[model samples]
Target: MASTHSTFKNALIAILATFPSILFYISFLHHHNNEDHSLWNWCNQHPFLLANVMFFLNVNVLFWFIALLQSSLHWMIGLYWMVIPVMLLHFYANHPMAQYNQLRSWIVTILTWIWSIRMLHSYLRRENWQLGVKQDWRYIDMSHQYGKNWWWISFFAIYISQQVLQMGICLPLHVVHSVDKPLNLLDFIATVICIAGVTIAFYADTQLRIFISKNQKLKQLGQPLVPILDKGLWCYSRHPNYFGEQMWWWGLALFGWNLGHSYIFIGAVLNSMCLGYVTMLVEENMVRENYRANAYNLYQKNTSMWIPWLIKSTSNDKGKKN
Candidate 1:
């Protein structure tokens, strides 16, 4: 049928569009590999590098296939989580002979895996996949906004572009894997910061989950609706979880910084910027639109957006002052 043909054509175009990003990622890997030894040149010297490249290609190809089959932007967005696992596999398979840094690499790899898995779990739960619910509100909005062109646009815009951004944001992992030095005091400090950030994020999410559950229960009981969370971590910052995420990335950057790789910090910087844009622009706007706009606006005015600091104008502070 003509419809089938059109679908096939669009799929082909999407696949073709991914090539430039693929080539760019390869070139980026080569450039970074050249910091010590050229990745492209060393591909001939070490067969493992070729295997690594192949693994990367296969994983992405699988992602593309899944995206096409599902036609769901949720899957496309979820592909970002794949970066952590792929990087971990690459680190383990291509581990250098330098035994000193092996422990450090293992630590970072494990932490990355943990963070990725936790985030994937959270996303799935929030989306409620078991009941066949799919796609978050943002993706739904995007679908409506883009109309029929959403399919191909999602391929090029969300899927491929996100992969590239994830690669860049994972620069710290690459740096950690490549560096030959042993874990030093700086690494220890960075590890502490990373642990702290993860802990904060975990607890922040837990608090939010509990709050939501309680609010839902109240609603079911026909009680008045509570539109916003203002206790626990939410009291200090409107986006405690986002702050924790930024802290975690910065901690990873600090690990690379300890290795004296200034460029690797770009990942943390980019991650922070992305979070800021999403939290301040996308998420806040959505909250105002969907929830109590005046209350959210007041919260935004009083609370730090991305840092856990006292909001002096909060009810508790006002009560104490009075």
Candidate 2:
């Protein structure tokens, strides 16, 4: 049947994507001891940094491969997502060759774990305890636009992009584990910021979910749905969750920044650029829904797009209130 063929294709695509990383890793392990002045020998000598980078990169590539086999991108919301951060923590605590830079590495690793776990928990709940049930709306739209090309395109556009973003944004994992900086006051600041970001994101996502569910119930009762979620975190920022996510990455970057690695900030900055695009897309999607367009525009006028601040009241908001 058609369904069977599709499943087989997805499986094939997943295998193809992951097999290269596995093969390369195996080859590296076999050749690591051959002191021939090549990158392999170099990696063997500096296994602490190189090995950690190689392992995390391979792990994330495998994630996208796993994602390819799923019915939708949602399936990537589990262990595949947590593996790098989790493994980073593990290596720091146990691996003999790891930098294990005292509380410096552990603090960043724990923050990464907390962020990943929080995201994993949120997505699991969002999917109603089941994943692979829904494709991201943008992914679906892209698939339709590209037609049959989407299969191959998905690998590059979605999977490959994820690998880049994950590795980039998680540069702290590489830096913290590779560098031997000690703990300092900056770490305390990083911890507070990281926790604050997570907490804010948690509240934002929870409030949005509640708002959505309430609207669904209203529709079920043949009542009008609430056109806007302007309460709590939403009242302060149009995309508090995005702001919080940015905070989390920048917080982790502080670990490297404190250790004199200013370039680590690039990952966080790139993440912000990507989030900016996503925010634009989400805002567009919101306004396209006729039921909420007017209310959302007014809400936009009353709030900052990313930063949480005092609500800006405009004449439109005042008139609406009257």
Candidate 3:
């Protein structure tokens, strides 16, 4: 039984591992505050110049996309324990050479530590961990217990794997692009977008956490909170955070486009396709499963799918047709 539990924990950790790199890389790629790769003895020579070069990479939006992909995977891995550290290590090992740009790498290391610690906290505090022996069970069993309808664990794992593939696309490019050059307009824009996207995502997540936690307390008191959050940003769109997330990645992709890295283009295309599919297929299905057809149909009628805009329809017309 102990061995089985360990295996189950490892599997969960594997799924979680795919995301932390995205976070670290995104921060490393987009941060404008530092750019030198020098450390102790080795030097990038032109510290400010290298920093400025990275700043001009015009790949901020790409970083946003990567961050979203990683964080999403981390959320799923919340079911497991050991996988969290391992995931962080996986990215840490693959991190672009800090020797090439010590300043940038320093920022990356700091953010990596922060992300790892927070992810660890979230996992430890999760319901699965609190469940003791039951928490030791496999994701398959957990899904069945929740409602055998969608295989949520597998769906999450698939998305996490896709995120990993996107990260792999950058490995070769990062190696080749290691040589630094002068800054450009595109890099400046990427930096700005990266900052903006992170801010937006953080805001949306904060709002969501508050909304859910408040509702959970209300539920415990025998009052039901409406599943639909129709206040603040939620009022404008069913998925304000999703929109912010998409913007973050698309923005990063734009920055990569400026770098003229072919692999960057490849990674962007694949991630874009996956993001589209998630929005239309996986996410749509997941939402419907939880809220049921009628609620979702109504929400859809009045909410934009990816963007935050006014509702185009308010009729739950699809539900009626069905």
lDDT of 3 at 103: 38
**Candidate no. 3 TM-score:** 0.52
lDDT of each: 0.64, 0.71, 0.46
Candidate 3 per-residue lDDT over residues 10-62, each given as its tens digit = 45544444444345456554543364533411212333333323322312223
Model 3 residue runs over 4 Å out of place are: 1-166, 169-177, 280-293, 311-322
Instruction: Return the top candidate by TM-score.
Output: 2
Query: Which model, 2 or 3, shows the larger lDDT?
Result: 2
- Model 1: per-residue lDDT, tens digit, 161-227? 5555666666676677656787789888888888878778887888888878887898899996666
Top-down TM-score ranking? 2, 1, 3
**Model 2 accuracy (lDDT, Cα):** 0.71
- Predicted structure 2, TM vs. truth: 0.80
In order of appearance, the predictions have TM-scores of 0.75, 0.80, 0.52
The 10-residue segment of model 2 with minimum total lDDT is: 313-322
Regions of candidate 2 where Cα sits further than 4 Å from its true position:
1-74, 77-79, 88-97, 314-322
CA lDDT of 136 in candidate 3? 24
Query: What's the alpha carbon RMSD for model 2?
Result: 5.2
